[model samples]
Target: MAFPIRSAVAALCAGLAATLLTTAPARAEKQEHAWTVSAGAHAPRARITLDDSTGTLNLSVTRDGRTVIEPSPVGIVTEQADTSRELRFLHRKNRTVEERYRTKSGKRLDRRVRMHETRLSFATPAGARLDLLVRASADGVAYRYVLPAGHGDVLGETSAFNLPPDARAWLGTYRADNEGQFTEYTAATAPTGEYSDQALFETAGGYTLLAESDLTGTYSGARLAHDNGSGTYRVKLADARVKTDGPLTTPWRAMVTGDLATVTRSTFTDDLAPASKVADTSWIKPGTVLWTWLAGGRPAGQSLAAQKAYVDYAAERNWPYEAVDAGWYFKTDAWDTTDPDWQTDSWMPELTAYARAKGVGIIVWIHQRELDTPEERAQWLPTLERWGVKGVKIDFMDSEAQPTLKWYDAVLADTAAHHLMVDFHGSTIPKGIQRTWPHVMTLEGVAGEEKRNNTAAHLTTLPFTRNVIGSMDFTPGAFQRVGLRPNSDAAEAGLAVAYESGLQMFAGTPESYDARPLARDFLDQLPAAWDDTRLLAGRPGQEAVLARRSGDRWFLGGVYAGAARTAEVPLTIGSGRWLVETIEDGTGGLVRNRKVLRGGDTLTVDVVAGGGFAGIACPWRPGVTTCHR
Candidate 1:
């Protein structure tokens, strides 16, 4: 709360006094006010604006009735509530809304509507610039990408619907979207054995993952996608369960980004109702990070040998955490636990203690469909809170219905209240929820690690597609060999880097890691945490490279789909002086094929394909630790 450029606080305090004292007098202005209080905004860069009443900003966004930006010491509004802070002031400015309307002819309709939306922008604190715009609408919301003209990224969007309030939701409605044109998209729920799926949303040329307990709630089946240039897009969701008084509308959240598998820098707002239904909004993280996951389902009843094996493998590698998969004690039958009386935490102490000792936290698994109701959630949440668990990897978004979407959101918020992180398996794509709730961590709404038989192109393209929505925990473990076609360990290392998951689930076994010490080098270079990240080179399915930094050490890893290809990686790897670099040529087998001794005085390299690469660069120091931001 560095004093906002003036004796602004003193003046605000005075205004606050006036506001508090005068509240009983005239009911304050019946409108919202314009809020311009931040000098600090982070970026991949975009310009954003919200128009409730033009210049006279009327809607006062408050947390607990007080306006606070995330991580706080910041305010949603810079000035105190005053006579000047009304719609009269907001009316002073004007902006255009970007959208499309419809009619019965299956074409763009000649129509228009004035939307009073709020503007939320993040000024990138001098790194990779990101800019975005947010617009709230009647049915749902739409986000437009600005700042960089060429960026057309697609991210996943997911929601839960009218789940009797007792159930939790791990969603895969994970939708994807872009700025320029639509892209072919996929989710964890898509029926396999298909070329491309049909668009789910019948209104526009878009799709959704509409899962529900019953079929009545569906406006239509989930929107599958096709020919969507990049990947499939999850534009918006309309939960049918929580009916609005006047019209059917989208959820309170929406997001957009640069590409399917690139970094998501811009985020927008979609909530505009007089009173929002999203009260349990506490668990959301405001920014995105590299998140990974590990499953602990089998570890619960296993011999201590298996438990230690799981823990030690993750611990020694510094892989941050693991998701305790379902069946900790026993599996629930097909009964949807709409009541809270069902106990889901039988092995809490044993598993949690096991994870804590290994220095790896557990993201316990839950089946929202099984315990699918608010009462059940209310019943189970308190118990989970008592378990000392770090997060929950919710599963099985079985259908795409409006009520189901709302149920999913409620579950996310509920999980958040218990201070739990999330990894959505059998889910959708990663949308930009990471910006709103950083704790949402990685989502497995796509064809992630769970299904091992996916093609190479699928693996390669995922980096560019699924990554844009922030971190994705696709459960990327791969110790098992694919077929023996003269064998290639190339993908193992590359996928890890290219996958860009903040909370990564290491793909191989400890024995495998040790067998190929080069793999260890890759692990040693991996950051369990990060301050910044950059998508270096290539695109989805073809080739992709990403570099992230933690303090002085930088971790650069990339995966290429097929045979060898040349890639030039340019990173503003901080303004530093460095000569020479070390890289792991491949994993699974020992041989560090590539070494730097040549005109190593300079930076940059030509990396190969089917082969992932990683390195830690530093100021050439002898017998010294590497220090590079």
Candidate 2:
């Protein structure tokens, strides 16, 4: 189901044009000066209310008869005029959008999304047109602003997420690199500070995750912040303003809602993004990669023999790639290399050639400064391609401003031209960029394995918050415990399946992984990309259990942060019996077992405190007693 990028874009344009020409004024329910737009023609669905009773437009959201978002201001602020309020409603149009697409790598390879869209048109005091586009699906709600045919500098946005005062939230403070832990707080008790776009809330009605999507280089990235003791998180742009010429459409302000399962499995982010821009995507492949920096420091990474050993390890385990982290170009202090003789003297060419001979690819790391411009990218990227390098891991971006985001777009397009895959480190959280550029495999925005202070609760919370948005390069699979509240060996193994990353980087040293044979064997057989995914059972911060399928095999993983407990996992994914193999934390170490179970049968797994479990199930056949890797 590989879609040619041109055809996909054409189809999308055709759909939008048709919607604009054929859609009529929507017949929404009106009470006084308020209009209600229901997600679907049913109860227990998401709803958005537009109120102008006070001579100003305000937006609110509800789910199943419970208020999720209170009345909040919604509009855009431009240099020419302030459209935030005092706007008169013009007309409204409603349409249904159904799209089916396939991804290069994600929780689900094939994705089908259906959303009801409503466009509410308004006019400023001076007759300038503004359109507030709202979209709703079973899993969430999103809204954006469209200033059609006329724009100047967008000063800021007045859109805000006013949550219920009693709701509990898990929020991450705003950082350029987005490498920080999420703190839990109640809406009233939450500190007033800049927060990431992706925030999770447990409301009385259900779970809600606030996020953004379809963020392009034309707009500066945004964060959420509020006054002291206020539950209204207003949108704050990274830069002061974004200049535009003819037309402008801001990124979507999305709120994913429902139960934990619904929140975890929602594809709302990608649903709002544009289709792929690369026409020939057959060269992009996602798989496991051995990273050198976390396993051993720069010294080990600099040594040619050590790199050769890692290449051998990846080759023997049937992995696709091995990543060489920083310090490959210069010894220390100097981040860039301008000396031409270094190319012949450096070991990268030799290493890449040798790795290629062993059926493995090399991914080299570079500082953001090295490829910050077109001339720099043109100078270095081709040399790496000629050296048989398969990918580039760009690091130290550390900003999401409009110019930086534009640089990212340029880098992706340039790297795609060179037929190279991309992994962004020291970067901002993913905002559906992978949907547009499928070659962008993974992004390191979370406090991942490199941050040894990560907790078991952090691992459990990721599948619901950060990872839900897109592919997360958490770099899981570390057998050795280095962090405070360190996870057990089984939990480390389970992370390989629990976390979704297109390019999963194992952070354990070869010796450490070899000592733990069971975990190592599981990593040897694990698939980096999945065809299907399901949340079996779990909650945020306490535990998480996920089942992902690739081909005919099913892989199940669970992680718990609380006290030791027995997790009863029902094998109810498919329709037949299965041959199951499981590994769990034992009193001595890891315990492995094999059994046969039906679709409805349950497998009881005993996990130690700060521990977890991993299992593989194969569809049963006559005379096949053991599940094959």
TM-score of each: 0.57, 0.92
Clashing pairs in 2: none
Please state the error at residue 359 of candidate 1 in Å. 3.6
Over 4 Å off, model 1: 1-243, 247-305, 318-320, 331-345, 484-490, 579-582, 586-588, 593-609, 621-629
lDDT of 1 by residue, 156-260 (tens): 223211111111111222342111112233333233322211111111111111211111221222332222222232323223222223221222333221232
Rate residue 501 of model 2 by lDDT. Answer: 89
User: Residue by residue across 488-591, what tens digits does model 2's lDDT show?
Assistant: 88888888899988888888888878888888888888886898888887788888889899999999888898798888877768888898888888778888
| Model number with the top TM-score | 2
lDDT of 2 at 149: 62
